[model samples]
Target: MNKLLVLICSGALLSACAGTNIVSLESSVKQLKDLRDHDRDGVIEAREKCDNTVLGASIDNYGCGTRKTLIEPLKVDVKFAHNSYEIPSSAYSQIQRLADFLNKNAELQVLIEGHTSKVGSVELNQRLSKNRAKAVENVLVENFNIATERVSSVGYGFERLADPADTEVAHSTNRRIMAELSHTVSVDDMIWTIYTVDQTQ
Candidate 1:
């Protein structure tokens, strides 16, 4: 009876401690909300805070900081012709812009995602998508001289369609590549990776 009583008391204490943490988190979120909503618009814009800061640097729950290092991710999409992994010369500008951003932010890592329209065989689409991603990756590494280790590529095939219509325009829209920038952010001593757009001008 004595041991059972002791175990029950310990469980209650642990539960109470968890409850305290929940309340603290709620309070902190509220405080951040109040501080960030400066224009009374009830929405916190990225320009209002250190939302453009760098990766691995210390930041608050709302991304405000005493000193921010990294900016947000800059999205640059490169389009492709149907059933082809060969990057068009027209898409070179987008790739160049991405290279410039990567060069400026050395600590930032990039993920180049390849996608295809739903007009080819599944296996063929998969291979083509991977190749498309690789093509972009090569441009950054070989042409721009960005480190290979800093960039990685993935192929999603036609599984994810940007447009579901059965029209040429829609298919053209689906046949493209997506570049996403991400970094790790810490909150309450816990670290998590977050993807945010670069709002800096």
Candidate 2:
């Protein structure tokens, strides 16, 4: 009887040890999985604060994207001849600079404002101002390869003058083209290669 009781107790101990081993194995597997980087974002799952990050995007130590909000401003100075809507060759350099800025910020839009002096009749000045604005817009679209939808032009005929005085300097200053490009955008803090999957095939 004593031998029989001892054999039963030993069997029970063996079953208990098997259960412990199974639990231990499961725990080890869980730990290894937590240490893996499923997203391949340089951070392990155990330490990752963000999940499913975009492939090849710049990320912090916690696997979160590092993006910055920036406000960029651009100014263009173009002078137009009296009673003329032609864009001067001298202003090409200024327009090129504006073009470069727009190309850098592909999502940005520009507003071109054309102004005229009060020497001509209001009707003539209005038409001339509008034509001058359109001239600049055309140069930007045709010569600089800027998108038509990204640029807009408006003419203010002697209404919003830089100098209200009826002097030669004031008139010259008033007859000009003004452009401003400003926008807020989120940009990656660091350069990274973008990965894309082609499905067209």
Candidate 3:
């Protein structure tokens, strides 16, 4: 009976070890699978693992998932009065469009940058520019109810002139507010489960 008990205990220990080994093996395979199928396409494409086609190819964090593509960043400019931060009636339509766009795209991040024409004291212009940026931010956050975290403001006083020429058109262009967008989509973000194979059978 003692021998029988010892054999039973040994069998249980061996079973536990086997279970641990299987789990460890599965974890290792998962890690490798993440690297290989970042896009999660069942069939591994040559472009996914490594790039040897183009000389001096820039690969992403993952060894696979490479494609030559061009995309334009989203940007919009809002013109302001010479010394005021108030939103003009003419700008209402543009602002409405921008607000609508932001509402539809919840994942987008925006930066509101304000500028001033070279018309006043540097300190005053800086304050005015900052106010203008804040005004736009307020419109988005208060009226449109956009989350504050998704929007930010900054001022560039009399600097970064859109039109460096000393002309009315140039000054008008210089006194403006710009909204820049930032969006990031990783390979994993675009990933989908193509198919699954049952190996248990």
CA error at residue 129 for candidate 2, angstroms: 0.7
Q: List the residue pairs that clash in candidate 1.
A: 52-71, 53-70, 54-69, 54-70
lDDT, residue 123, candidate 3: 100
The residue ranges of model 2 lying beyond 4 angstroms of the native Cα positions read 1-68, 187-201
lDDT score of model 3?
A: 0.70
| Model 3 Cα lDDT, one tens digit per residue, 1-201 | 112212223254455432232211122222343235434444244445553323223346534445544433467788888788997878767777777777867877688899999888999989999999999989889988889998999998988888889888998998989886644443322222233233223
lDDT of each: 0.74, 0.81, 0.70
Model 2, span 69-131: residue lDDT tens: 998777887888778888889999999999999999898888888899988889888887888
Question: How do the candidates rank by lDDT, highest first?
Answer: 2, 1, 3
Candidate that would win on TM-score: 2
The count of residue-pair clashes in candidate 3 stands at 2
Residue ranges of candidate 3 with Cα displaced over 4 Å? 1-73, 182-201
Cα shift from native, residue 117, model 2 (Å): 1.1
Kindly report the root-mean-square deviation of model 1 from the true structure over all alpha carbons. Answer: 21.4
Instruction: Compute the lDDT of residue 101 as modeled in candidate 3.
Output: 72
